[model samples]
Target: MKPNDLSTSSFIGWTCKLLAILIIVSLVVDCSSKKDVYYCPMHPHYTSDRPGNCPICNMDLVKKEDTSEHKDHSNASNSLQAAESISNEDHSSHLSETSSEKNSRELILSFEKQQSIGIKTELVSKRNLVKKISAYSSVAYDPELYSALSEYKEAVRSSEFLSPEIIRNLQLRLRQLGLSLDQIRIWTSGARDPSELILGGKSGRAHIYSQIYESDFTTVKVGLPIKFKTDVYPEKEFIGKIKSIDVILDKNNRTLRLRSEVSDPSQLLKPQMFGDTVIQVSLPNVLSVPTSAILDTGKQKIAYVQTAPDKFQAVSVQTGKNIEPWVEVLSGVQENQRVVTESTFLIDSEAKIRFGSDSHAH
Candidate 1:
């Protein structure tokens, strides 16, 4: 219509368009604030309603992914990263599902991973654990046997001056001094008279002398089994029994010299023949674990006990009487419980890195 009317219409239309744009902008801002939540990718523990820097990591916060998918990835990432940290300060405390389970160093290993890493397990059972004492021994003569030989000579000579009764009594003394009945018969048959009588100086059997430490002295007992090995015959094993133990201990090493009687029918073992002796003293039935199951971190010895089918808890255990393949458990483990036998070092490394906390913390 008129020029002023046209200007008024144009101003009204421009105002309406500007108001619509502002309203649309306000709606988009409100929707983004309510629907989209941002979180720190580096520090997954830090989350925000909108984009900002992470308080812990100081990194820019990013848009959080789908809740279910993110939770799954976070759990897996935490388990793997639990063993990969080097700092003394833990960056994963916020990821723990429960504070009580923290510092337990639990690991959830899949069946496939357990098989691939050679992780094995065994039951803690009550069994006889032997304390093996290994030491160098020499084939020596028993001092009493030598005195017996001297007594035999004296008795044979004394018989010339005495009656037949005294000679028979002296011959019987030889039998009490470890001489066999056959040996005494041979002595009497060889000599025509008492002066011609000759007694064997050396005993046919071998006397093995081994030094036992003070720690193992109490466990060592008479009739305990011992096996001997010589350089001359490496494959041949000479089994013996502990015959005697010295009352006095060694001044330098604080050890006891024990004797074992070994039968040498072939006379392959001679006096002063050096040999290595292994004295096996069996202990009473106690809870024991496999040697491969335990991991020692200098101060603390650790073992992973399977708490669940796929979960394991790193437990500290007291060890005693460690043999080649088995070790006695003093405490920290119960009877019939399962313990990890292999891949312990790997589990230990993971535990320390995580500060013995939940491996799958999220």
Candidate 2:
């Protein structure tokens, strides 16, 4: 094509391209003008074109307040007094909604606070809370059985390896030595065999060296069936019949010795197993509460009494054996009174806010 004709074509093409670009730019601006940006009420710094939670405070994004939405009530009433009454009515409705929103906000805050603190509670009842006692006791082996096994160990070593006639001769010699034949047989076949003794000779018994309070022992009956468990074998339970309750106090350990017979012959029960033992006592018509509801601080125990919706009053309690998820309440609390089963801590916190320093005192 000729140079003049080509230059004219190029100018026309460039003009068309610029016109398209202007149209696109105009559309983008027009769309942006119609769109709205939102922000968070709690954290004002958070702003976004799309609605969502505030990145800084996790509060919901709200629409920016627009003053233009207010109605022009200038002509609603002709007289000044009438206009004033209308204005007051509108103001009251606005205030009512504001108060309701505040109440809802407080409820949400309380729920979240209770959840984060892991508060839980139980109900209080006054039916004869069982007069019970729970105390730790050490395990021990029978002293007589333990001593008999020690003597057998020495005699077995010679007999287990000896020939039949040699064994006979040894037995006759033992009899001549003035030891009874029963003793000889016991050495040969009984715990005298080192392998027969399950627990070590000296360390055979799990020693219970701890002591119980003198008054606590009075309620315990001799020959009462005892059921217990230990940490070593958590799934296994051991039951024993009380053989004797020692009247003499152990001065060194300051604990009373309560001898018991193993209910079952299974060797599953071992010494040094530390777990709770339940000594069934006769507590006539005693009331009990779910152990999960009680907050125990060792020196004293406390439970929250539900007075109203989400409202509770702290009550001091005397607790007995804990069966886990349930506890024996010796005194304090009444029947059918709902306690904060899941979020008692929230009530405790509110109580703290109401009475600073003394919140958890009870």
Candidate 3:
């Protein structure tokens, strides 16, 4: 053989050997890829047939360590079956939770529907609301007060002939009849008689006889503003100050008798003039809503709160004193929220039908 022919044979042999090594490497890679199942550890539900990144978590797929080759075939089959059953159960539970959560947080009403239902809303306010307690009363002269004044005056006049002990006892008695030291001292020095005190004193004032219920007795105190309106004088509002509250309860009515002194400048509030009294009690700034916003189902007091422009949610609130058109909101709403004021009953009816949470029906 020539030298060129030998060199050609050597080149062909090296090429064949290189091709054989490449074929073995390709087979090994194919087998390894077939055994490997790639999955994202961050998203356990995601798996890929080939090694790739997870679509959801954007994390690199991790190769699951293969136990099928080392374990019994029957055991591998049983494990696969168990995993499938658990996965189905988990998927169903996840779907149920998603549906329930969606319903719980949302209640969508169209703007047109809201207008048709005559819905009206007002922003919850944190301001002073004068909690008013009401009671029907009659104006009358204070006889007991005048009688004590007379006895006190008589004791004072006879003090020159009477003992010092008698004078001290008389002073104590005047105090017991609800007279302050200033009142008795002023009465003694002044020229007003007992008859003038009974009918109409120099001030031409009268006392209002009222009953404060057990619930109101504790909250009411002297010096609170009082307003009285009689049927005869409809427009006139007689303002007064609470003078005294009886220590003993009225046995017949089971209420506390409260006496308020009203100066009758117009003399409209005369003796035996029947009137309704409203006591304005000042309270600290608290959360409040309109009285029309509340809907009581006997057991629960609910108010419709506007979570969105058209969507309203029914929330149970703890209520306190009522001041005419407004009421104290103790809880279940914030000061900045908007509450449905007018047509609240209609909103509540619809909400109950839609949400089906009328635990207290009838």
Candidate 4:
């Protein structure tokens, strides 16, 4: 137990401890090097000394690439960073191309929409210039016959020679002779009742005479032709000539009559048949269009001028004398222009609705 001996023992113990630690480290290194013998490139942390699959990821561990000649860690890091930056640039370029394509598509759609709007606007502007007029008229009968009946009755009572009983007996005798009592009474009353005013009373039994427009006499030139179609035989057209035109107007009816003789002279063309009369004023040839082309709305007369397929513009026009399927256009129309004949109502309504909506938007 001397001090020097103690110091020497301490130094020996320290040497043994150092040698034991060195031996243990060498054994551990040898064992680790021989363990699994494998490595993974994707998971650089995996380093097995023996051939085997990576425990962290199910991949066959491959031998680590030899990089001992370029062992600088800083150089490896720089190469990886450069590759990552190039990949990012490529992705950015792809994104830019996609955005440009989308922008181009959007521009094309907008252009198409604008063109559609322009077309609609043009159509509306063209359709607003037409005028339309519509009117309604009814067939009327002569009123003077009724007025004359009243005057005739007053005259009969004023005569004082024939009593009411005598008038009744005369009416009864007329009825027995196949004449109506009303007819006799009307005649005795001095009323110019067209139905009661029979010709050749008791003399010409089969013949019946009727009065017509008296003022039309001037037009009743010899051999002048007249055509008429009675409602009784609507299908049959009767051709006639003016036999006589009375110069005197019927005071009650205020209308003159023309007596016409028909070629057939059939009983079908009887007096009191209601129908339309067409008088040819003997005018020269005139330009006209089909009456179907005109759309009448009382206030104005409108016609559709076809501009394109399913496209039309309403035009205001003045018209005169309508003949079946044809009418005389006085103004505001042109020749050879296509006009809407069918489906006019649909076209007119669509045009108006479109125009109204457009105006509201504006």
The deviation in Å at residue 221 for candidate 4 is 9.1
Judged by whole-model lDDT over C-alpha atoms, candidate 2 comes out at 0.58
Q: Which segments of model 3 are wrong by more than 4 Å? A: 1-92, 95-105, 128-134, 141-200, 214-220, 227-239, 249-254, 264-273, 278-284, 358-362
Query: Roughly what TM-score does model 3 have, to 2 decimal places?
Result: 0.58
For model 1, how does the per-residue alpha-carbon lDDT over 1-362 read when each residue is reduced to its tens digit? 99999999999999999999999999999877647678888877777787878888788889977787789999989876766663323535544535656655567788987887788889999887767789888877555555555556666777778788876776666655534555555545543222211221134456677888887777788789899899988998888898667666779988888767776666677667788999887777967999999887666787789998888887778987776678889988899889999888876666557663334232
Better of 3 and 4 by lDDT: 3
Choose the strongest candidate by TM-score.
3
lDDT tens per residue, model 3, 1-362: 99999999999999999999999999988877756678999998888778989999789999886676656766888899999989999998998997665455345689898889898899888887667799878876667777777777888888899999988888887766555676567668764455544565236566787778877887799888898889998988888888767666667878887777777865555666788899988877867888898888888898878888867777789888777678888898898999889888887777667767752232
Please, what is the whole-model Cα lDDT of each candidate in the order they appear? 0.74, 0.58, 0.78, 0.51
Sorted by lDDT (best first), the order is 3, 1, 2, 4
Error of 2 at 300 (Å): 5.4
TM-score of each model, in listed order: 0.52, 0.37, 0.58, 0.33
After the best TM-score superposition of candidate 2, give how far the Cα of residue 54 lies from its true spot, in angstroms. Answer: 87
Model 4 misplacement above 4 A: 1-224, 227-239, 244-256, 263-284, 308-310, 357-362
| Model 4's TM-score against the true structure | 0.33
279-362: candidate 2 lDDT, tens digit per residue: 666654546777666766565677777565555566788876553445667777777777566655555566667656444454
Of the pair 3 and 4, which is ahead by TM-score? 3
Which regions in candidate 1 have their CA more than 4 angstroms from the true location?
Answer: 1-99, 112-116, 128-132, 141-203, 232-238, 265-268, 356-362
